[model samples]
Target chain A: MAAARSDRAPRRPTISDVARRAGVSTGTVSRYLNGGHWVSAESSKLITRAIRETGYVANSTARQLRTGRSGTVAFVVDEAPARFFEDPNFEALVVAVGDALAARDRSMVLLLAGDAQSAARAETFLVTSGVDGAVTASAHPEHQLFERIQAAGIPLVNVGSPTGLEDRIAFVAADEREGARLMAEHLIAQGARRIAVIAGPAHSPGGTLRPDAFTAAVDASASEGAAPVVIGLRHGDYTVESGRAAARTLLAEHPEIDGIFAANDQMARGAIDALREDGRSVPEDVLVGGFDDSAFAGTEVPLLTTVRQDFGRIAEELVDALDKQIDAGVRTNVIVPVQLVVRDSTVRPGS
Target chain B: MAAARSDRAPRRPTISDVARRAGVSTGTVSRYLNGGHWVSAESSKLITRAIRETGYVANSTARQLRTGRSGTVAFVVDEAPARFFEDPNFEALVVAVGDALAARDRSMVLLLAGDAQSAARAETFLVTSGVDGAVTASAHPEHQLFERIQAAGIPLVNVGSPTGLEDRIAFVAADEREGARLMAEHLIAQGARRIAVIAGPAHSPGGTLRPDAFTAAVDASASEGAAPVVIGLRHGDYTVESGRAAARTLLAEHPEIDGIFAANDQMARGAIDALREDGRSVPEDVLVGGFDDSAFAGTEVPLLTTVRQDFGRIAEELVDALDKQIDAGVRTNVIVPVQLVVRDSTVRPGS
Candidate 1:
C-alpha cells in the first residue's frame, strides 16, 4: 500500500517523460498530452501508460506561468570509449564547436548519447530540459532520436550530415567529397595507378561520401579509360586496431595495389605499416593518403599525406547555425572546406 | 501608465550582470538573492539596488519549489588551450568522470575557468546554480573560486591534489612525485649527470612537487658531498611552444648538461628539437625524460623516456570520488601510481 501510494501521488505526469517511456517518440507524447486533435487512440494509450509508469506529476500552477528560456545549448555526441575521444579528428571537431559556442556566451552541455537507452534518455532530457537549442554530432546515421527531437519542435544543428534526415534538417559538415577528390588528385599526380581505398564504417555519411568522391574523381581524371584497378575496398571501424586488421586483409587480398587512400588517418597509418611489413617502401613503391589530417598524420613514420578539415571553423559554423535557429527559427546548412596536406607518405623527397 | 507597465516587463538578469552592477563579488550577489543568511545587510542592499536597476527579481518562490537540481558537474580548468581536449590525458580523465556521473544520471559541466572573472563566475554558479557538486582540475595554487566552492559547502573533488585546499577537500591525482623519482633514478642509472630540468609553471603544486622529488632522488643517489651539478632550471607554461622556449634557454645557459628532464611530453619534444638544433644527439650528448607519457611521447623522434600517468585511471578515480561524494556523502583521496617508460631518448640500443 505504501509503495502504491508513493507511485500514485504524482497524478499529473509530464508529457516529455511519457514520450521517453512509451518509446513512441516525443511528438506523439506531446500531441497526446496537449490534446492536439491529431494523436491516434493507440498512441494516446501508450502515452498514458508511460506517464503512469514515470510518475511525473506536473505542477499545473507553474505550467500556467511562462518560464523564460535557459541560454544553454546542448551538444550531444557518442561519448563511448575507443571511438570519438581517442580519435583526434573527432576531438578537434568537438573543441571547435565548444569554442564557437563559448564566444556567443552560450553554455554548452555535452550529452553522451551513445546507446539506444542513452539516446532515448537524451531525447527526453533535451525535450523537457529547457535548453534553447541542441547540436547533434552523432556520426551514426541510424540514430533515430534525432528524428524524434526534430518532431518535438526543438531547434537543432547536426554536425555530420547523416543520410535519411538530410531532406528535412540542416547540418554543418566537412566537405568529404572535395577532401576525397583532393586526396585522389594528389595520388594521381604522384603517378599512382593501382589505388585502393579503405573506407570508414559503411553506414556513416562520412564513410560513404569519401569513397564515392574517390571513385568519381578517378572516373573523371585524364587517365580516363583506365580507372585505378580498385583493389580490395576494405572497411574499418575507424579504430587503430580495426585499421590494422583492414590493412592485413587488403595486403593479403590485393598485393599489387601501389597506392592506398584511407578514409581517415588511423587507417592510413595502418596501411603504411602493412606495406612496410610486406617490404614495400612508402612513397617509393606504394604511396598513401588519408582523410582528416589529424595530428597523428604528421607523427607517423612516413608522415601521412592526408586531407585537412578546419575543425575549428566547422564548429564555429555549427554554433552560428545553432544560435540562429534558436533565436530566429532559421535552419542553416554549412559546408566546411578541406585541403590536402602534402607529406612524406605520398612524395619521396629525393625522388 | 499601461504603456509604461508593458514597457517595464523585464529581461532576466544573470549573476554576472548583477555582480557588475552591484560592485561586489558574484558570490555575494548570489548569496544575497538566495537569502544565504551569511551575507551582510550592506551587501544585500547593494544587490537589491542592482536587481531593481536591472529590473531583476530572484523569482524565489519558483526557484525554491521548482528548478530541481540541474544534474550537472562543472569540470573547471586553469588554461583555456593547454591541450585540454587534444591530449588524451585530460580527455580520458573527463570521460571517466562523465561516465561515473552519467551512471548516476548526472551531467558533467566543463567550465574552462581560465581567468579571474571566469573563476568568480564559476564560484557564484557553484553556489547558486542547481548543480549538486563540482570537480575542479586547475593547477593554480591561489584559485580563489576553488576556495569559495569549498566554503559554500558544495561537495568538491580536485583532479590534482590542490594546495591550500588539501585538508578541507578530497582529490584524485597522479603520483607525480613518485613518478619523478622513478624517472630521475632511471636517468641516473643511464649515467646522466649535469641534468637540466624544464619544469611546469613554478606557481603550480604539480610543478613544485615533481622538481622537489627529482632533486631529492638525485641527492639520495649521490655519494656524501659529491652531488652532480644541476644547471639550467627553466620554467614553462606546460605547452609545446613554452617548452621550445625553455629548451632553447636551458641549452644556451648550460651547454654541458648531459640530460634534460621535462615536466611534460610537449616540453621534452621541444627539448629534443633544441638538442638537434644545437648539433647534439639525444641519448649520446643529452638524454631526455618527460612526465605524462602522452601519445606524442611515443611518437617523438627518439621516443621520449617519460613517466606515464594513467590519465584514464585518474579520470576514473576522480569520477568515482565525485560519485561517492554525490551519492553516499563519502569523500576519498586517491593517488594513482605512475610508471617509467624507457624509450630511445634515454636508452640507446647498445647501452
Candidate 2:
C-alpha cells in the first residue's frame, strides 16, 4: 500500500527545484513565495522566471493534504453578535489576521460562536469542516468553544492568554498586566489622587488581569505611611453603554475620584461621555486612560491616552504559532509588547 | 457506467425518508434541517427522532459533490482594509450573512480584494477555490473583482445595485436613490433652504445615485420660475475625516447653507464636528442628516437623522438569491425598503 501510494504521487515541482533553477537558497525562494517583501528585486525576478520554467504551481492544498492538513483555518470570535459588531478592536484584529493568512496563501473562515448552540455548531464544523487549524480571538473564559476544539485534538492558537487552559494550548497576547500598570502609573503621574476603574467582564482574561494589575500598581505607588484608598471598582461587559453605566455608579459612590482607568477604549469613551454629562472636563478635571487604542481613541474630541497593542504584530505571531504547531507538532506562547500613547485626555491642559 | 454509478451510491437515508417517518411534508423536513426556526416544536422533535432513527446526516459537502456543487460561499468585500474596518455597515452585513449561511449549514470564506493584485488573487481563489457561489458587498463600480467573478461564470449576488451591470447579475440592495430622496425631502420639510451634500466616492453606486437623487428631489420641490439653486456639492470617501473636509469646503463656499446631507453616517458625524467647530448649532443654524443609520448614528450626542436599511433582510436576500442560483440555475434581484429616522440633529430644539 505504501509503495502504491508513493507511485501515485503527482510529479509536482518542489521549492528546492525552483531554488536550484534560480541559483538561490531555499530560504530565499520560500520568502519570495510568502510575499516577496524581503526578497531583492533581482532575486524575485530570477525566482519568478525559474518557477515559470519549472511549471511550478504552489498548490498549497495538495501540499497541506500530504502533511495531514486541510489547507484552511478558522478565525473564531467568541463574542455575542451585538458585542462583536460594537467593538472595533475585534474588527482590527480580524482584518490583520486575514491579511497575514492571505500573505501565506491560506484562506480564513470566520466563525462566531457565542452561545451553546453556536458553540456546538462551531465544534461540529471545526471537526468535520476540513480546516487544518484554528485561531480564536476575544473568547470569554467561560465559553466552551475553545475547550471543544482542544478536546478534538485540533491544532489551535488562542489570540489572548487562555485562563485555565494556558499551559495546554498555544497563545499569542498583548501583555495586559503591563498595559494596565502603564495606564495606572500614567494616571498617578498626572496627579490623580482618587482613581476608579471600569473593569472589563469578569470572565475575560483582560477583564481579570487588567483591573488586578491596576489595583496592584496603585497600592505600590502609595507613600510610605499612606494607606491605600479603594474608591470605586465596577465591572462592565466592554460595551459603551456598560461603560457609561459603570461611570455613573462610580460618580455617585466616589464623587471625589479624579482619575478613571477603563480596561478598554470603548469603556473609556463611555466614561468620557458620563463625565461630560456631569459637567466634568477630561484632563482638566479628571484624567482618563484606556487600553487598546482602537479607532475611537483618536476620533474623540480630546484624544484618548491608551495602551496601543500592536494588533498587526499580534496577528503575525498568532499565524506563526499556529503554523509551527501544525507543521512541527510544537507549541509556542508569544506575548507581543504594548506602548503607551499619550493624548489630550491624560495630559494636563496647557502644560 | 450509469448502472455502476447507481450501484455505488451510498446507502444513506434521504430527506424524503425522514419526512415519511416523521409524518410531515418534505418541506417541513427540509426547513427543520435548515435551522428549524419556523418549524413547530412538536414537529421539530418528530423530525429529530426520525433523523436519529434513520441515521440521517445532512452532509452538505457530500450532497453538493454528487451534484457538482462546492458547499462553500465567498463573501467578498472590495474596500480598502482601513475603510473596511472603519465602516460598521460592512461588519453588520457580514455578521448577518454569516448567520444566514450558518442556518443553511454552509461555510463562508472572506475575501478582501481591495487593489488590483489582491483582486486578481481573489479572482483566482474564487475561480478555483471550489466555493459554490459568492456575495460581494460595497464594491466600487470600477473594481475588477466583480467583472472577473462574472467572467469566470461564478454565481454572484451583489449587495448594492451595480451601475452598468444591473441587468447582468443578481443583486440585493436598499434603494439608494429613494433613500437619498427621502433624506433630502425630510430636510426641506424641516424648513431648510440652502442645502449642501457630501457625496460618496464617485465610482460607487451610492456615490452616484444618492447625490443625483437628492438633487432631483430638490429640483422637484422648488417653486415655479425658480431655478434650482446649487449651494455646495462635494465628494467624500465615506469616512469621518473626508466628511469633515467636505463640510469645511461647504462652509467656506456657502456659509449660509442651513441643510447638509452626507451620503453616510461617518461623514455626517464629521460634518457635525465641522459645524460645531465653526460655532454653528445643529438643527438651529444647520440641520445635518446622514445615510445608513449605523451604530454611531444613535450613539452620537444629537443623534443622527439618517436612512435605516434593513441589513438583516438584505443579508438574508443575498444568501437566498445565491442559493437559488446554485440550486436551480435561477437569478433574483431584490431591492429592500429604507426608512427615514428623524432625530435631534434634524429637529429644532423646542419644536
User: What are the iRMS values of all candidates?
Assistant: 18.9, 11.0
Report the TM-score of chain B alone for all candidates: 0.75, 0.80
Q: Residue-wise lDDT of candidate 1 within B1-351, one digit each (tens)? A: 434432222223455666788899978765443322366646655665554454332221223233333345667765454356645566666667767766755555566555554454454334323355678876465546565565545678888777666776799878988998898888888878788888888665446788878878887786334355567688887777777888888878777789888888887888888888889999888889998887777885788888988876787777678767766678899999989999899986688
DockQ of 2: 0.12
What tens-digit string does per-residue lDDT give for candidate 2 at B235-331?
Answer: 9998899999999999999988999999999999999999999999998999999998998799869898999989999989998899888777788
What's the DockQ for every one of the candidates?
A: 0.04, 0.12
Q: lDDT values of the candidates?
A: 0.68, 0.77
* Candidate 2 chain A worst ten-residue window by lDDT: A2-11
A223-314 per-residue lDDT for model 1 (tens digits): 65456655668888777767768877887887788888888888888887888788889989999888888877888688889888888888
Docking quality tier of model 1:
incorrect
Which one is best on TM-score? 2
